[model samples]
Target: MNKEDLLKKYFRQSLSEEEEKEFTLLLESDHDFKALYEEYSNLNLAFKSHEAEELKAFLTSIDEQEGVKKIIWYKSSTFYYLVAAVLIIALCLPFLLKPSASSLYNEFYEVYPNVEQPVVRGSEETNTYNAFKAYEASNYSLATKAFEELLQTNSNPNYKFYFAMSLLNDGKFDQALNTLKDLEDLKFSYTDETLWYMSLILIKQEQPLKATSKLELLDKLGSSFKSKERKVLLQKLQDN
Candidate 1:
């Protein structure tokens, strides 16, 4: 990609590994590109601040004008400021609200917690059970390893789903997304659930529109399991 597109992707937190590496190299080796990026960053901050302060002043003035006679909100200068301020704030809301991808991930990502059938006491437990035990105990490192081992012998979709979760917990996001994407297309019982997690992954990657697309797909599929969560998350993402 060119320098402008690379900088835009970097600001949007959507750079791939190779793109990120190239962006870093440009910052280190190209003085003009580095200077341009710094200038743009500063300009963005200044614009955000200006919009916020203008919006706040307009809002405060509306409250203060509540008791004044012969001066309606729409009839005063505050109204003009309010209109301009709202437009600017709308354009800059994402930066102003500071929506955090990690915060959203932590809020919605829940562990499956248990396997379908509980192992009976005195029964011979296998590596699969051991993996579930590790996951239940929150030992994701060991759980991820055990999950990979399970996948080696059996291509159980359930095992693959849990393995994807383990990778997500371990912060292997790209790998986890890839696994979830494959699961989403498999028409398994978890295909809907896979779509939900994939949407969350997209949100965490700062790709809200992509996440919205996934949510729309889930809605079209009539996924009752995640319908409410999907709606709430989609609203929150779109709001920012």
Candidate 2:
């Protein structure tokens, strides 16, 4: 194939094992070949290691942690993982800039995570928790009402997180975006889930610049959510 085709295949990630092996042998041949390989190799590394969305989320998350210049070691590690999660999401679906956070979160549910059924509560909390659970189940309208009520009661930040997310699943796009933007202002424990959802919301809100900003940090902090997700997100960032 021509150089252009090769680059195209590489971008598509459609390289066959035999083609890869032949390419590897070509790399071993001489300085000129090595140089050519290096160019692509470096580009591939950048594609794999760079993540703009993760960076955007990190900056958004850290800015809210206004109490201390430095967090405890554990939160620091958590921060590290959060960056990883951003890259993972980006990598899995290159050019999926407009995907709903709900879709990605569903993939997460299928992974090693166990289902945590929320406990039933008083009227508003009950409705909120139920709405969140419905959101998890991919039910939108019920969750929207539940989350809206939960937001009014102001019981817990965690619930609020779900409330905002439910609004998204329900197609209350404007409301969901507004809720998440408010969450960005308040300092809460930044879960990968929260950031992932927030990133999707940003994209839906037509904020590619913000998404690219997060990708930078996530690329640096690798192996989060799972290695594949990290690699894919990193690739997307670099490729873009």
Candidate 3:
């Protein structure tokens, strides 16, 4: 059988003993064939890993919100195969559709929530409060200034993170990326979040290859921050 047929059976786990020997020989002797096999193997593994993570997160969210016991559906082999098949198709459909990177960015990008400060009405006009208020209001230009001021004295990663986000929202892509890169090197609560935004900014800048690299690193680091969305975006980027 040709290498393509070999790969098909290999992914399906249906290669006969003789075919398996041929596959191994090709892998050992043909550099390009080995690379092709590795590429497909990695993509398959990524899809499976992404689906499993999504299922787990979904059940966990249901349990948290509804106070119900988590379903253990993943323990069943039949259910696993069904989910894998469905997700592979669902995930591949976007590539078949050939959506642009800009559309994908719009689909996936949302302003990070202000989990640090509550924007209460008629509250005291503290600098921190003002910064978060502007961010919540979508006045990114104002938020950027406020965050910059706060970072001057505080150097708080939280403030810097929001500052970077504000820059991103304000279309200051270079500055936002630089700030995020700095955050990536620091030990902070927002490392995954930082990587996530960095990838988004790269996408917005029409740098899909760079964005994919960031996404791949984020995936390798096993970040749960936007794990499902990240996997989908990563696959789409790869396809493009």
Candidate 4:
């Protein structure tokens, strides 16, 4: 294909794997193509700036013609600003709105820090307490090992939850999701929370459809603790 078509496909992320590889090779090796791409990038930015200025001028004209004197403060200037913001967002959507799964993960993922009381009352000696302490300190590797050792004999539901979180923090996404999958299936007290984390894992793995699916299930389950947050996340995924 021509440079124009290749660039268009690249921008749209519509190139096939092979085509993308070819494009990358050309971009790196061909000075002409590289310069063309840089030119295209600059032109893209310029076009966006020009369009934004035009949109702002149009909105300003409307506000001036309509006059803001009669409307309430809450409804007049606020409403017009809101309208302008929404229109600007809509106009810039194709270029500015990145709805990739990794973007979603970055926007939403947060580690569930240890909130458990030490299993042993005042001594910082026991394995369980040490595991909780490690987790609280964000020592995920130590926490994972300790949680794993504790679970070998205990099989405590809470232990599994913490283990999954530790694994997640350590970037063992698949293992963490496996443990969370078990928790979700059991419908345990932490099931909704499990689903929430599982969604985040899928998102980090670039599986937005799967992430959104899990979020939808969590929304249906409706945990009192996570209901509002879950709804907001679900809406965000759906909007994307």
Highest TM-score against the true fold, candidate: 1
TM-score per prediction, in order, is 0.57, 0.43, 0.57, 0.56
For model 1, the superposed segments whose C-alpha errors exceed 4 Å read 1-98, 117-120
Tell me the whole-model lDDT of each prediction, alpha carbons only: 0.84, 0.59, 0.89, 0.84
Q: lDDT of candidate 3?
A: 0.89
Backbone N/Cα/C clashes per model: 0, 19, 0, 0
lDDT of 4 by residue, 1-240 (tens): 888899989888799998898899999999999999999989988999999999999999899766755456547778789889999999888747757677667777788866665544677678888889889888999999999999998888888999999999999999999999888888565777788899889878867789889888866665575666777777877787
Summed over model 3, clashes come to 0
The residue-by-residue lDDT of candidate 1 on 96-180, one tens digit each, is: 6866887887788776555643545675679888877777777888988999999999899988898888888788889999988
Q: lDDT tens string, model 3, 1-240? A: 889999999999999999999999999999999999999999999999999999999999877766532244546677789999999989989765888767888999898988988999898999999999999999999999999999988989989999999999998989999999888877688888998898988887889988988888888888788999998898878887
Best by lDDT: 3
Ten-residue stretch with the least lDDT total in model 3: 65-74
Residue lDDT tens for model 2, 1-240: 654555556557797887667666665765676776578778877866666667877888777675454555447878889888988887966546644434533433221121334444443556545765667667767766776776687656666667766666666767866676666645565444455555555555556456545544444444164446545643543454
Arrange candidates, best TM-score first: 1, 3, 4, 2
Better of 2 and 4 by lDDT: 4
Which stretches in model 4 have alpha-carbon errors above 4 Å?
A: 1-96, 119-121
Superposition-based RMSD of candidate 3 using all C-alpha atoms, in angstroms: 31.9
